[model samples]
Target: MHKAGIPLPNDQVNADDVKAVQAMSEKLWKMDLAEQRVALAVLISLCDCIVWWTQRHK
Candidate 1:
């Protein structure tokens, strides 16, 4: 398989480069509700950071 390209914010959805996410999902599924909330918060924070970083360069 060819190397997957960097996906743009609005690029058409495709099934590639999600192994890490799948792993995270499995781990989260095993966690209790409280732990899941913490994990979700962490993911949201990372998203915020990425958004800030991208806009900072534009």
Candidate 2:
């Protein structure tokens, strides 16, 4: 998997999580340049939501 350029999370990472991120990145990369930009924007938005949620919980 590492040879295939799959990304791994930190020391506490799980197999399924790595696979999921790999799949998401692959799908994003397969898009056209404009589409990929849009996809990335969406991803950033989602990440922001996650961060906000985590902060709220704290």
Candidate 3:
């Protein structure tokens, strides 16, 4: 994802996050186009939630 220019979570990210992302990426590559789109959409939604929560808390 970094190689693809996608920004990763920065604040408070830990080893588990890295492992999970790596694992997800491995599976993501094996997915068909439609499945990949859905996966990406879900990822985007998660990011949105993170951003919203962060802003609300700060």
TM-score of each: 0.52, 0.50, 0.52
lDDT of candidate 1 over 4-55, digit per residue (tens): 2322122333467587557655654766676556656766999999999999
Count of steric clashes across candidates, in order: 0, 0, 0
Candidate 1 — number of clashing residue pairs? Answer: 0
**Model 1 per-residue lDDT at 36:** 59
lDDT of 3 at 11: 42
**Scored by Cα lDDT, where does model 2 land?**
0.63
User: Relative to the true structure, how large is the alpha-carbon lDDT of every model?
Assistant: 0.59, 0.63, 0.68
Instruction: Point out where model 1 deviates above 4 Å.
Output: 1-27
Q: Encode model 3's per-residue lDDT on 1-58: one tens digit a residue.
A: 4565544443443577887768756665765676566658878999999999999999
Instruction: Show the colliding residue pairs in model 2.
Output: none
Over 1-58, each residue of candidate 2 has an lDDT whose tens digit, in order, gives 2353443322433567987767766765665676556655766999999999999999
Choose the strongest candidate by lDDT. 3
TM-score of 1: 0.52
Clash pairs, model 1 backbone: none
Ranking by TM-score: 3, 1, 2
lDDT for 9 (candidate 2): 28
Global Cα RMSD, each model: 11.3, 10.6, 10.4
